[model samples]
Target: MSNLSSIYIHVPFCTKICSYCDFCKVLYDEKWLRKYLTSLEKEINLRYKSNKIKTIYIGGGTPSCFDNAFFEQLLKIVATFNKGKDIEYTIEFNPEDINENKIKLLKKYGVNRISIGIQTFNKTLLAILNRNSDYEDIKKKIKLLKDNNINNINIDLMYAISNQCLSDLKDDLEKIISLDIRHISTYSLILEKGTVLYNKKMPLISEETDAKMYNTIVNFLKTHGFCHYEISNFAKKGYESKHNLTYWNNNEYYGFGPGASGYINNVRYTNTRNLNKYFNGNYFFDKEILTKKDVMNYEIILGLRKIKGINVKDFYAKYKVNIFDEYNIEPLIKDKSLIFEKDNIYINPDKLYIMNEILIKLI
Candidate 1:
């Protein structure tokens, strides 16, 4: 059974590009946006299977960077799809881009979730990353969102920059927890090829420091009543991102835009990152149809990213192979890196920082 109930649309236009970001993005321009949205409509109408989409995540190049009229145009294009009763339409915003009018516009369009990209409250760090929003601006933007009744929000936090320390992260976390936000996603900075930071030869925080920071974040969030549902995500009660769960659970979804990756009919495909090529109607250039063994490997890797790990029974039912018999998980269990409890097998909380190492050992 193919569960293609989620849609991911990429708007590759940003008001300003962050030094650390490597996503397929360009500076904001009206002519390009109008053309991109038109192409987006064409791409969605061509690729989407017309399933009643339960979640539509409009990710950036800063989806909130436009004027109200242009925002309405983007909304109208997505409005072509059939939305479920409780649709989770989320948009990523930079605090500087958010205003009283755009906040209300999002509400009117049935957007229930907002993910703000406030990478850090540290002004010095913001300047280093080429970001404009400051801590005070973030506070005002958040208050504006709440006043307009759009409270299902997620705050993105970043760490492991060139000069960050454990105490700096502690300070950042304390300030973040005080914001009354529903969800928080923390990512260690990855200096990828082609990114300005990577090009500048910026050094990464030491492995020991990075691991310590990860542990601190998890323990701190747990104490504050946030469930560490996914490795990098924490949420209050039922606020886990429904759209992301579709991917973590290894289900099929529609990915429509330049640089979007999607799995459908057991084939994984990545759209071409070249915007000019995309605008000229070359949306996808790379795809792989999975074999049964490939699917099994993917399931093991993706499912394990969740805090609950994998359900042993679900594995047996889905692939008709005993998980223990198919692989040597018992070795990992013996090493205390993996834990099996309540019919679920998960990475040990203490070993989550080295989860990739454990997964490599398992698969």
Candidate 2:
């Protein structure tokens, strides 16, 4: 194995912090921006192993917010990697952060994919999440990217916002479908402990309503020519997120920058989210080497997230134990919570909402 086919770099600076975000982030500062990119270059030089990389994803605290000079420098550092002819290089952008100049820069540097943070189209819901993009802004930005011939795009959406209703959700979906993008990732809001929304005690709608809305979105997207291939993602044919698929398939990759995580050589580790610690060259919090059982458990938990599920033959080939014998799945299948077909074991569509409970029993 070459050990470095995929890479993810986290850029932790944002122009405006969203109320619901708990990810490692800080408000953008020019001095810190220069220092952070320097440190990022150092970290990449030290840890990145394989020169031939295929899939690269630059995620954020709003990566697209970097000023043009710093943004070019950041791209220059990654360009050192030996890239394939058609590497799936992606960068996360905010809807308002992109313009003609940035679009040109991205295309010039071979960034083939763009993921936008357009959480919702409703005004009140947008304000509640502290997001600032509007319909016109997003539509224009999408056109800008496509006009530059960077057609691979993904947009993020959120539901279960404070005071959100089923009708509001359906309307959002209709607008999103009309955009004709390649990928969409929709998540239900979770009130993380330290976020502004959680501190303010923003209302999380009823579980019944949440369930209904989730089901509605799934059906709506399916009806609109999107494949609900993963739990929280849909895509047109041949446009699935290859970088994320690396994680779901349990493949190894590099995670760089503050608050990053990486798995290599059967060991999983998370870098420190502490900025000062990372700047001081202290990145890892700890590392855990997986035992056989631990690896199998991870395989099941992550693989089951996809619609195709886990292949039994591959499982036995990897672990030398039939999953049927290692863990009791027959009962789940019998009860209609899971299905075994085409030599793969998958969660039933109706039971996907309760996937956690079923996974608990499997583990």
Candidate 3:
């Protein structure tokens, strides 16, 4: 079997565009959906090395927005993969797109994980981000998934919007915890260039407030029994996202569909975001072949993202080089900005907010 064991399929069609989103997406259209699927299947068949994939994440532009027939077809296309027996198949969804029929199909196709974009239960913040979801409606949807035995569920909770207070975030966390979901992915609102919020020049909450909110989330979730497994992810014990861990661990995986990216054979590549170009079969947009040094650098950068940090022995095993000899970690360790505990080297829990600066110094 090939070494690669994870797959991410991007379905770039959304029923509604959010003001803060700059992902590759367009309005849902049946015509485009049919064409996109055809190209996606061809790309997978052409590029996939036929490994027994252990995880498959169908993400982006709302994978749950499709009508019944199209959704089943998408699942059928994915079923062709040589999946492992205990696969963690996941599909991202907007809360409103979920229904009994879709849940049944997901159960039939063996999709065990569901990541819902419940980016705050506050009505005001929902309007600000142009997202449509009612708290009651969201609860009902969660119940539906659980009733169908699709219990490995995750909900996204976003914060740091303009004019949002720490109280607002606390309230959102309370509601989220009450849902009894297994995982929570938290994000601070970022106004990327070309996004509606960025174009409108929406003011961001101060860095000071943002940091406070992040700490609040960390503390609150910990009290509620969620393990802060990664920088932006928390889960009940044994419920962490295996697919995302694939990226943070800097392992190879397959990415199909427009705007998706994959790392294979020591090379990282992204497919074109342009639909027209994608339709014409120009699958590759950009690629970088990594040198040994390049790969090691990636190892440090991606591996450090996990809260547990990098295993020095694993680093040496993979690269045949000592991590400390290669980089200046002693200074950070001396300053308590990084912790070298046992065999693992991780960022200091207190200094995690400024991790970028520390990484810059080390890299």
Each candidate's clash count: 0, 0, 0
Model 2 lDDT at residue 232:
89
Worst 10 residues of 2 by lDDT: 1-10
What local distance difference test score does each model get? 0.88, 0.89, 0.93
TM-score of 2: 0.98
Order of all candidates by lDDT, from best down to worst? Answer: 3, 2, 1
Number of the candidate with higher TM-score, 2 or 3: 3
Best by TM-score: 3
Show where candidate 3 strays beyond 4 Å: none
Candidate 1 ranges with C-alpha deviation above 4 Å = none
After superposition, which runs of candidate 2 have C-alpha atoms over 4 Å from their true positions? none
* Tens-digit per-residue lDDT, 172-262, candidate 1: 8998888889999999999989999889998888999998988999999999999999999999999999999998888888898889888
- Predicted structure 1, TM vs. truth: 0.97
C-alpha TM-scores of all predictions:
0.97, 0.98, 0.99
What tens digits encode model 2's per-residue C-alpha lDDT throughout 318-340? 88999999998999999988999
